[model samples]
Target chain A: METARISTWQFFILALGYLLGTSFFFRIGGLISIAKQDAWMIPLWSGIAGVLLVLIWIKLANYYPGNTIIQICIQVAGKGFGGFIALLYIGYFVHLSALITRNLGDFMKINLMPRTPIVVFHVMFLLVICYAVTKGVETISRSTEFLFPLVTVTFLLIFFIALSEWNWDRFQGMFHMNIWTTMKETRSLIGFPFMEAFVLMMLFPYVKSKNRIKVSFILANVVTALLLSLGVFFTIGVLGVTRASHETYSLFVIVQEMHIGTFFEHLESTIALILLIVIFIKLSISYYCAVSGLCQLFQVNNRSWLSISLILLVSGLSLGFDNILENIVFNREYYFEYMLLFAVIFPLLFLFLTWMKKGKEKRKVVGSQA
Target chain B: MIWFILFIAVALATSIFMMVKQKKSTKEIMLFSTIVLLGFADWISIFLERKFNPNHWIASFIDWISL
Candidate 1:
């Protein structure tokens, strides 16, 4: 008897926040480094592919309403095998949470505050996450509903503000490069930002409306893609390819230069402050899913009991990276492939079986009618 | 390290207290405590200069297979 407390609207905002969270700030430069001027278009194609990927989850979700990916896994496969698979998913989410925390900690240490111990930022953020998530998933969604509007307004405001520095000449050589080859080179992006939305399957079951759930997520994916693509487009236009590619945060580099008359100079921290909250929303979703899945696996009634432990667990793990370069290197070389099994293979098998089962049921009904 | 230990002790005490107060099953309580203790031990190990780096493990595994 699970009650759905989140509206499709909140679900859309949560998806936007979660998908864009740490990546827009941290991962954009790497994309720029690979594709140069055409980096802007990568997310668009990635968005289309992401839609196809999410469609599988949507169909599975529709087949079994009110049940999470974890529950569905346990149902479709036997308990021992399925439960073990579900546990792996939980562990994956936990690892993702740790990575997101490390991303923020690394960002802050490198760019914002160098002297403070990284653990302070990790623990502080994790503490807030622990508190919010312990209240339950609906609390996370409701808070996302409240704060997402401000993120949007600021996003738009920064967009207009950055437009003043745009130069079209930077895009001069863009059309010469082959599109198919570019896509092949930068395909890892599809995994990092788009396919990774597979994790949202955990949140999909909680959306109050069933029919239009696909629209909410597909629209969010397209919108986030557009926003991110626009971000890359503007970064190249303002800073050019070489400069944008080198900086850790190409968009933040653009923001740092936004000087409206005399008043709003050095807006990097301002943008950082907003984006850090977006990252917080992202971490909370992963944290909630991991905790909820673990609780489900263990049959623990009060999920909050595990919250404190997970904070320590994630924080400790987050500090494992000696610095940002190794983290970036790991992500570039291997993160996507590592995510392949969970994001693609498992869901495909689940949908195939469910479809087969549905077809058999339909055939049985037809025979009875005859 | 002392403060970290104290924080863990207090956290464990309160959570287990609440679990017991809510009349949760002993199995649930044990599982919760075990995870928390595991996490606490992990953190303490980090501060003691003996870190367990999962990224290393994952990366090496990926490399091992790639070869």
Candidate 2:
């Protein structure tokens, strides 16, 4: 078991940063395209469901106090099956790291560095992430204490400036979609941004205050969902649904629209920098989880080799996607379902097994006492 | 491609320098060396632009299942 412990505040900020991650930059358009004006509601509703999922995760975490989800799997499902599940999770975390890295590279290529090869950005960022992960979770979480405030203040600045461009008409037809369609659109939110918090289960054992874990996790989700919803709401109000849906980076587009008598005509780059910082924190956390999870699974005491290897692997794999469009399409069509199974369905099943095992142990104790 | 190679070299050198300074074990060194070798193999494949791409493979697997 890893002995590193982070403060509850650090864990809270880490969760918030991870939840915001690439979603801040890339996910809004998908939501707007699906829900139109009602896209903001997706996060609010999904956040409630996210809280339930977090509760289940917390229960499982408390049940296996010092063990990660990987170890929990081994304990709950037995050796062979649990190891298979753990391996699958390892793949999931690594894949998630790659996808987020690609997202960052793609965002930079499109908005900021159109001339530079995307691979360069991937390599550079992964180098930093590789270094951070080697320093362990505490270091990453401490860095977020600075980054989270910077991102929040910058995001708020963009939010307030974009208000000048908001149009009430854009919010028309809010409930035009049927219930089922609305719910379907929300799966993208729930599965991708929200359930991605499931990765935090790996870090739960590292949090100092186990008793406060559930509250911090849920609070972090609420704040992230509110921020995301506000971002989407502002995008639709400023750009309208049609324009917002068509644009890849709706927040970037909105920030580009900010104009204060020609003085602040070009703030998109500044805003993009803020988004990049938040996404970096997000990617670093996921990268750490992936590398450390592998270390735990392999029972490797020295994580330096494994961390560098996985970082290289992820950075290289991120270049596999032909372009950002293919990645977006894949996320919309398939990635959520994949994440949902592992993040939500599998955890619930694990919880059920845990309950059953506990019941059996209780019965065994009672029979012994008798 | 040259920049890619340079970046990888710098990253590996820095990582090794840190590990050695921190006195990481021999097993750790061996493992890190193996990963660096694997990274070089990947770089060669990427330079060659081979059709057997892991990225496409994973994407295709997800695509196939989602379909």
Off by over 4 Å in 2: B1-45, B48-67
**Model 1 lDDT per residue over A14-117, tens place:** 99898876667876788888888778888888888888888888888888887888988998886998898999899888889998998888878877999999
**TM-score of chain A, cand. 1:** 0.94
Most accurate candidate by lDDT = 1
Q: Give one digit per residue, the lDDT tens place, for model 2 in A1-370.
A: 5678899999999988888767877888889898888888888888898898898888888888988888888888987998889988987887888888888888888889899999899888888888888888878888899877988788778778778887899898887877687787567778778888999998988988889988899999998888889888888889999998999988888888788996778988898788778877888888887777767766778666787677667776777667877877677766667776788778888989988988999999999999
Model 1 chain A: which ten-residue window has the lowest total lDDT?
A1-10
Interface RMSD, all models, one decimal each?
Answer: 1.2, 3.1
Clashes of each: 0, 0
Assess the local accuracy of residue A304 in candidate 2 as a C-alpha lDDT between 0 and 100. 60
